[model samples]
Target: MAISCSFFLFMVFTMMDHHVGGHENVCEELRCGGKGPAIRFPFRLSHTRQPDHCSFPGFTLSCTDSNQTLLELPISVKLFVEEIDYISQVIQLSDPNHCFPIELRRLNLSSSPFQFLFHEQDYYPRGYGLFNCSQSTDQRNGIFRISCLSGPTHQVYALDLNDGQSLMELPISSCTKMYNIPYVPEMGDANILHLNWSTPDCRHCEQRGENCRILKNNNSTDESKTECFPRQRNHAKGRTSTKLEIVGAILGSFLLVLLVFAIYRVYRYDKVEKENQAKIEMFLEDYRNLKPSRYTYSDIRRITNEFADKLGQGAYGTVFKGKLSNEIYVAVKILNTSKGKGEEFLNEVGTMGTIHHVNVVRLVGFCADGFRRALVYEFLSNNSLDKFISSADVKNQFLGWDKLQDIAIGIAKGIEYLHQGCDQRILHFDIKPHNILLDQNFNPKISDFGLAKLCSKDQSAVSMTTARGTMGYIAPEVFSRNFGNVTYKVDVYSFGMLLLEMVGGRKNTEVTKENISQVYFPEWIYNCLEQKEDFRVFVEDDGDAHIAKKLAVVGLWCIQWHPLKRPSMKVAVQMLEGGDNLIMPPNPFATTATTRTNARIPAMDFRQELQVIPESE
Candidate 1:
């Protein structure tokens, strides 16, 4: 019984030691305690800890060795955590030193991701000490230039660490020319620490109980301050010396303990990272079956040819121009890792994969390699509709009265197809000129089906919790149902805005003071028809006044405020093609504020309106 009890106690002690040693092993491997000040997470050593998430992955800390207690990140960036406010979710870090070959002073401010935490404070430059060096006087006394600029001028230097490297480089001449000294009292003689000095400061020497002396060089005019070396005290010979050695050992032991703890943290971080990669790979494998095709990161590099030519960027991704084969050109859209909407990518790919339409841009293929997701589409030479209509010079060349009418008709037909032609009704939440791409022949192709939603064909409109679509072009029903219940007619409202823009040769909302008072443009177009006046904003030699009147009438017919009153896309297409004598549209902006509020239209039953037929038929 005695032997068994002894063995059990030994096993328990061994288990305790093993657990404690596991943490110590990590600390020792990293050597974090010896490096510098140790900072741990719920904290990060750098601002960019991981791809998108703000805080460091695994909430690990870093330990570094410097005058400032710096935390070295896994990415090899060293940061000084000045303050951490848990309540505000803010961390203030000191400006990093620039030691690279590149003139890092400029790069520090612009390149570094660290942002200022203070609401209104601005960053400034670091100040240097200035001293008046004369041959007669000992080069010790000097003025510290703390606050130089007093008036309304901005603060040129900041004392807070949040300032970053805005003012990193101190002027070398500032030490001599400004006749100023640093606020730190231990910085011996200012002259020795000055740009021209060769020796150390004497005030530091005096603090160590050494005499201050001056060294003069034959070729140099400036005098350098030097300190007399101190003799070491022998503990065996004195009682005071013995006490100091014991105290030194105690401090050293404390530092050793901290160092061991730091190293353990780093070791644990490496192990965790490896485990995380393995789990991510397994998760991706499961997702791969659902994804159409798996492209390697190497394949992406080969396809993009090292991101040779960047097309443009948008909210979700960056576009790159690349050739898939000898004859085929494709636009590669690389999803930004910072955007946390991975589900949206899957939605767009899955939806577009099943869709094939002449007026819609085709998705050739896609790439899902780890965190790097991309989509490949057939390249459109003419870019987007915004390029042509938005430009003052280009709008006339590609978009004339004839072509604009054809484009408008084509767009309406396309939306009509999505509503009734497809197996499922696809609600394009965003409809604007920007989303409309043009082919080589100036044909409008609806692009960017990212915000699309698939609903039943029988439903007149799908209930939406959040409002979507571009401002100004959005239907009145979307903001308030006083206009009408939300339906696909919202698209008609946007189509109306686009039609008006095409007719006016510019955006209708962009009316200037020169034109605002003189019959609000859309209203003016309506009044002109009422009086049978010529409707022409731009009267060039090639312009057709009759065609302009037809487009204005069709645009007014589409934007009737109430979805019930607005024409369907099929009707809109017929109206665009129809000659004059189309029925007059009701005034859209005539509703009184009181009546609009009181008689608000309730939620729509999409089934009832889904059977709408073209009125022209």
Candidate 2:
């Protein structure tokens, strides 16, 4: 039983070998005949039916029913395969263009898997040859050559199957002048035009006059047939040679597939790398042109001490204190990721990079590492101006009459610089006391340029859609502009409110019981001045009355209802510095609040009502 099983297994193995060997005869159908050349190996007839080794993945070849072949690439590219030579291993293709003249040339063998069969030792004794071709307007042609050292004599040639005459001919040397050759047996004589050389002795077998035969097959008649040939015959026998050829073809196909895959992967990797490099280059270009200091995320971590202490928080980011190597302190702001305000951050960085003024807060550096965005600013020890004036307790401690005036002037100068000093005029859309920071010397520096907008200096007024300034500080035209068009006077209005806050040592909207009737404090001050009543309550000291009056007049001038009526920061700075007590302002509350006549009549009516109550008593 064991011997029988072994015989059966041997028979099965023999049958399997016969089946495997028979698959090589599955000849591919050939379709040829066209004005152009027939498309062959290295490229298949269809993108889907291509040989596994012929094309790269995602890259395919298409042979149209009209006989034109096409190479499909990732990026849009169209090429027509004009000619292909199986013997010379070269292809000719034409570039389609309109204005540019189209020319035909040999396919770049180096770029493809095909190699020219050359005698290496004879053609290139040392190395390859490099050449240059120049075309002259005078129709002059230039030629240059390099000689081989020592080997068998060989000549450069190409196979032309299209002519149907000589199978071998010298290649038409037009533009290309560089080539490398390899050494082999009489490669020059074995051409399509002539077949004279004989096959050499088999390297593996020393048999004198051996022949090929089909050793095994399903049909006994086909298997019995065998043919022999002379040793001098150029071609080998059909069966044995076909088997070797099929095996070599399969191995070559695999190598071609691997080469194509490698090329595609390299191309894709390079393309992605280029795209990322382009993004980085674009960012760097903007940085270099804008002169913004870029910081890495790790640098930010060191500077902010891993975000140890928080200074404050806003809707979009948080501010942290950091110390630089110079021992100079800075406030680092880390922006929130969810907030879609990266454009605003970039604008602020771009604008601040070009601006350098004593009254403007300095931008120290910035970070834009993946997912992390931060801005570093020079630390202001005194913090925001709102800290001093908004809170009642801290107001008197920092903001004296003289100090307030100086701060007002400094802030005015800063706004003026933004409006005029820069190449482009900048508008602070959200100007308020909270946006102003004070230095060590109590000098008010305009901060938070995040909302600043750039406009051409030549333009008189900037067009705005939505109002951005603090509610109370926003200009009247910005809300109801039927009165007139809004302009830089918007900033003027905010500056006016800031000036009032400075002078009053408090916010203009005082919530005291005595001033409940006076909803608008500026109007209340106006009514007092109109009534010729003493406006001494707001005066901090009798000695500083002159300063007080100047501030009041300047504030009133800036708060004019119409944008055109309001003074520019340039003029306001002059007015504040000149220390001039100008004319009293018009009744700004006349349109909304009751007049002095009506107010007096109300008081008189109340008194009359009190007198009438006597009868009930």
Candidate 3:
């Protein structure tokens, strides 16, 4: 009876092995046309291949009657597949209908796993051309009258004319069609657009002699991501690789179980064995070279006197007064454990550990004991610059225009040090009056490295996942990649906002008595400067007035909408130091800087909410 059962099972296994082998053989084979290039794996011939054999929905290739391979995209646009390079993972596609240029704007691949293949050598800058206008206006000096579609009644407005302005200001009032064409629109026949796409990303796996197979099925999309596994080696003629793999896997599992049992016994001997060996390696890697004194949870309590003297509180953490020695005073900030990824603690330690400057705040030590984390810093005598600034009142606490100018220069110098002085360029994403601490002599020092990012000095931009810094002080580029990538200029923009705040003696956002929101502080200040208004800053003499104007002009220059428009921190320092002769910058508040009149914010109450202590701890 046992012999008969074994024979029956052997027959079933043989049949299954044969079927799998046939499928593998078919998958490895390439499909080709009479004249077209051969395609395989990611690209499958829909007629010759089974639905389960294809990797993705959009990757299927169809052969035409004339032997041309056609690729129909998700957008219902069909293109002739000229070439496919599996090595580079690129598919060359050209519109079958040569008359109509592919609407590049509408060619979105957000849902697909492909990206536009843009090459610098073959790239061409394009501009919009408004054509077939019913009415022709007087702004038609460079507007060419297109006689192809219609007679002289149709005018084609090109961006090449009139200082490269947008189609938003098009003179043709009744334009029927607007299309974005190559800058040199005369070269009609040479208008082949190239796009590159990447997906399945299995080139490396193929290089390692591995086969890619779908692990999970996406029932809704009818496609799924592919995973790679090593190809099974054949053992003999009749005996299949599947049976050998199963027997070997069983033996390996038994050995693994025995090894794990031994390790468990050893681990039990030392109960405090590393919770996660991988996480320990990562922790060591992140803090390899950085030297900050790590403190225990008890040490934090001892330093803060059991949370006795509270200096200030914020959304993230609370600052407390801690004494290191008889003469040494340090500000201890205990972070809320449940809030963030604990990146703020890492940022302050890693960034501030390497720097030493008067204008920039100093980092003394840090504590990262389990979840209880705290940061210690040299406490300033005067808390922050926010207490000194108020639009409604500044009579007794007026620092005078000259003094304020000194403070601005000091702050600028600190930022310059952070940018130019450090081995790596450090960007203080949060740069506002609240973050700027003052000394007894009223010298401004930049504090709060929690939101700071460090990048190479030569690096043009720093990549960020989410926007950092206060909402009012955030640069436009930080919020949207359309503005530009986040760079050191982000700090410059924030500084510009801060400088304007200092000059205006008010928060940037305000709610009017009539419930209609007024212009932003920077806009209001820019208008005041443009019209040569007094700015209402307490100006005792000509020097004070000159100082205020200088601050305002530099402030305006720093807050230019585009990153390239704003000067570098080095140049900004020069401008701040170079007295009286600074040129008035152009209006930075272009059409993009729109006012939100409906936003009802209690500006004074908000400012008062974050008011750091005026006196030292």
lDDT of each: 0.57, 0.59, 0.69
Q: Put down candidate 2 lDDT per residue, 330-361, tens digits, no spaces.
A: 99999888886586587668788888788988
Best by lDDT: 3
> How many clashes show up per model?
14, 5, 3
The digit string of per-residue lDDT tens for model 1 on 45-85 reads 33322221212233344444443544343345445544443
TM-score of each: 0.46, 0.47, 0.48
Candidate 3 RMSD to the correct structure: 24.6
TM-score: model 2 vs. ground truth: 0.47
Candidates, ranked, TM-score = 3, 2, 1
Q: lDDT by residue for model 3 over 401-506, one digit each (tens)?
A: 7678788888898998988888988888999999888877888888998888877766647777788888667899988977776778889999998888888887
User: In candidate 3, which residue ranges exceed 4 Å CA deviation?
Assistant: 1-291, 509-519, 592-617
lDDT of 3: 0.69
Give candidate 2 misplaced runs (Cα > 4 Å): 1-290, 391-398, 508-519, 532-540, 592-617
Which residue pairs collide in model 3, if any? 116-196, 117-195, 117-196
